[model samples]
Target: MDMKKRIYLELRNRTPSDVKELVLDNCRSNEGKLEGLTEEFKDLEFLSTINVGLTSVVNLPKLSKLKKLELSDNRISGGLEAFAEKCPNLTHLNLSGNKIKDLSTIEPLKKLETLKSLDLFNCEVTNLNDYRDNVFKLLPQLTYLDGYDKNDKEAPDSDAEAYEKGLDDDEDEDEVEEHDEETVPGDEDEEEGEEDEDEEGEEEEDDVSGEEEELNDDEDDVEEQQGLKRKREFDEEGEGDEDD
Candidate 1:
């Protein structure tokens, strides 16, 4: 469908001021131009019009709240000054797969004070020597060009990273909970069984030790009594001989 009808359908009965994001990718445009979009979309923060055959952005209405713009896969060559005037708060812009040739074509983007990322993959300008370094130097405000910094580090996908980390954290918690649930009671039961066995063994050893001690004491008492009787009998016989 044409860009106008596609945008209207995307609204789905919501007014333009209430819309925060709009996706118009792969839609037909009027001779490579934006149409039906107006300044009434004051609350729009993101707008994607990729592959819409747009050659310029001269018709973009003032979107002071816009932060990200996707105009990739279009015929846009230059006239990026329109972005600075219309989407003054833009931070991310994708112009990949366009007819952009050299540094001069994108030099106008320097006016975008808040622009941090620019994607120009498949554009002629990427073939230039030191293209990345030169672009970074030209647009000092930009932190990334085609998803990499001047240090050649890839951009961090915050949302995806957060989601994966969240899943990992949840998995770790589940593992801990499962281990506690399955192992704790079994460990307690094993410990209790070991204690019971030890107590029983100790009781049997005490009983045997007590019985042996009592038998030894009885034997010693009997020997002492027999010695006393013999001594007394001997003394009595000597006294009778003396008397005779």
Candidate 2:
């Protein structure tokens, strides 16, 4: 769809003045020129027109409140000076996948004093020798280029990044809790198994004691019978002597 119609659809029953952000990505522009956007969107803070076939921002409406702009995947090679006057407060500008071939094409961005992050990924200029160093020197106000700083550290979290990180943290905590829960049951089962083994060992000991008592009783009965037999034999011999 055309940029104008797309913007209207994205409004979603809100007036332009009430809108804080707008996205018109992949919309057809009129021969690389923006259309259907007006200055009434003064309250807009973020605007994205990615892959809209824009070769220049000369027709861009004045947006003093704009902070971030996404214009990646266009044919824009130069004329970046328009941003200095149009979006004076812009801090992050993404012009990746464009036709920017050299430093001179982007030299106009130096006027953006508040600019902090600039992305030129997939552009011809990135292949130049000492690209990052040159860009940093050209725009001293820039703290990051292509997502990294002069020291190669990543930029701090944005609102979206922080939200995603929080979700990951929550998932990790849940996994730990599940692991602890599972371990408790396993420990209880181990303790129960040990108790069962102890009970079996006690039963075996009692059975051995009962068998030993029965064996002792049988031995006492055999001795008593042998003593009675000896006493009877002595009496018979005495009677025979008396008869003789």
Candidate 3:
């Protein structure tokens, strides 16, 4: 039997019921693909935290007073919604270094309004667009995400936008501060690039405005043709009435 199974058997056989925290880091729950975790730790009523990092225990037993949970570096793909329903008082969650690719899987955690911090570092969902934005919007009560504070709104939009676009991650943030300490050449070239970008943006806007005007003119012409047709129909009806 693997270490995880041995440890689980130990929990079932020897562990007491009043155990508050069950931390089986590194998926040490057991081997041989144990099924139905709700039965394994069924007696741990006062269990507050379950730090089973690197374990493959996807389904957990119902713990009423559980608050903090750590399940990093495991094969936990989904089923966070059902898990959140059973553990409503959950505050701190660490699912970093897992196989979590879908950001939607954690949407269920929004129901736990008491949740203050969430850790999804080194996960595949970090590659999603506006990962931090969507997570914050989903869980407004969250004060921290991936170790960053939620109230840190000091970053300018240009920096945030570049970070979202993946252009800022590989670049060193200290580059500008280092450059500021000395008289750097080619500063004007950067300004010229910005000017060129602004000009291109203006041209694109002009093109869009021209397209909209042409569409409006086409609509006006169609309305004029319809008005003329209606007038002609009314005249024909009047003539028919006079002939009668």
Candidate 4:
């Protein structure tokens, strides 16, 4: 028997209340065998790197006392819901280089308020949006993730760049709208100015027409008076000649 089996058998024979920490690092055990070990060591507070020999589905039994878990470099696939449901007190989890595809595998882990560090490097995970706030929302004690320190200044620069790009796009849109407004003519103001010019033009035309009409009427009156005088003189001369 290997050293892992011997240690597992020893722990199994001992009372559960006596065990606190279990370190089976670099051990060679398949997924099914690992599950059995976890069940046998349920009272253990620390479990480290026992999945090194796993080549199939990884099953971690309900270990309520487990505080730290390290399962790095395991070929385990599918169903992390078991981990979240089983290990409620887990604080540190290392599942780097696994084939975990969806966020659902990690969803059950959200309840672990004590989880401080989570390693998920080189996984098949594509969407980090859903777990962005929900996973860490309750875990104020958490500080590190995926081997990157949260306080590292170099990490957030990409997020900052995205935010700046969004703001710049908004500013450009606003500037375009303002420029359009300035160039466009106000219909109400243009119509009012045109109406005032039309009224002034009509008044000037009416004044000119009235002056021409008055001048024509004055000339007609003067000509009529001159004709009456000429008629009177001709009649008087005719009477004189007849009388002689």
Ranking by lDDT: 1, 2, 4, 3
lDDT of 2: 0.94
Worst 10-residue lDDT window for candidate 2 reads 181-190
Clashes of 3: 8
lDDT of each: 0.94, 0.94, 0.68, 0.69
Query: How would you encode candidate 3's per-residue C-alpha lDDT over 3-66 as one tens digit per residue?
Result: 4564565465555454555544433334422232454354443332233433343456566566
Quote model 3's TM-score.
0.49
For candidate 1, report its TM-score. Answer: 0.70
Poorly placed runs, candidate 4 (over 4 Å): 1-6, 9-16, 31-35, 38-42, 55-58, 126-142, 153-244
Task: lDDT winner between 3 and 4, please give it.
Answer: 4
Which has the higher TM-score value, candidate number 1 or candidate number 3?
1
What are the RMSD figures for all models against the true structure?
5.3, 5.4, 29.2, 18.3
Task: For residue 226, give model 2's deviation from the true position in Å.
Answer: 44
| Alpha-carbon deviation at 41 in model 2, angstroms | 0.6
Cα lDDT tens digits for candidate 2, 60-150: 9999999999999999988899999999999999999999999998898999999999999999999999999999999999999999999
**What RMSD value applies to candidate 4?**
18.3
> Candidate 4's residue-wise lDDT over 140-231, tens digit each?
55666664455442334455899999999999999999987876668668889999999999999999999999999999999999999999
**Structure candidate 4, residue pairs in collision:** none
TM-score of each: 0.70, 0.68, 0.49, 0.48
